[model samples]
Target: MIHVAQITLETKGPRLLFLRKEDPVRFTWYEDLVQEEKETEVFSTTALEAIRLAYLYWKNYSFKTLNCGFRYTLPERDEHGNNALFHQMIASYSSMNGIYFDEDLGHNCFVNFASDEAKNLWKNLQSQKRL
Candidate 1:
């Protein structure tokens, strides 16, 4: 399972903290993330709760945004005999006048997840809506 520790969002985008559940020892720590990402915020929790909590806060200020989008990791394997880190992302923009045009950006993309549970966790996050 992927343990979501913290989530930080700025004018740029959202940053999520996660740790490989079963392989904490060999969990390769990646540096090069932004300054807001801190090791001190590790909550050792799941993605659902983290996302739910974030939605509560983001919705308060993101009033102009009427639509939400998400990316989900796929479970299929690639030709290398390894789990393919494919992902899907979709977007639906709503206008104040009620007109809308959607985009399925997930058409061609690859993603990396800590584990299979991370994929399931992302699906749960997608089910939640604030607007």
Candidate 2:
């Protein structure tokens, strides 16, 4: 049986906190998701502008940005052997939901779990025994 971890988010003011639970009291937290309320609020204004420009490159394009939290693994020497396998399992399941790996960003190695569509997709795929 494949066991996948869960992603939880806590929004405090404009900063978003990401968490992953393991043991009862052990929770790993890292990274922050800041709401881009204004153009200046974005960390990389230039990058954001570039993305917006590229997004508009396609005609009649409708971009839907969803808040799908991310799941992170510990930085360990044997991460590839242990964590990678587990992460892959989670990511595979996440892909069934609308969540995906943000390869364009530095978060390429991490799994992003967000989107109810992805959750439904994963459920359907599981029912079909394709996953």
lDDT measured at residue 76 in model 2 versus the true structure, 0 to 100: 26
Each model's lDDT comes to 0.32, 0.35
Q: List the residue pairs that clash in candidate 2.
A: 68-114, 97-118, 97-119, 98-118
How many clashing residue pairs, candidate 2? 4
lDDT of 1 at 55: 46
TM value for model 2: 0.26
Task: Give the Cα error of residue 87 in candidate 1, in Å.
Answer: 8.1
Query: Worst ten-residue run, lDDT, model 1?
Result: 85-94
On residues 53-97, what C-alpha lDDT tens digit does candidate 1 reach at each position? Answer: 434644543412111223232343243422221122122111243
lDDT of 2 by residue, 19-128 (tens): 32334443332223332211111121243343344335322333222233344533321233222222243564456553445343334344444457445634654686
TM-score of each: 0.23, 0.26
Error of 1 at 38 (Å): 4.1
- Cα displacement (angstroms), candidate 1, residue 35, comes to 5.2
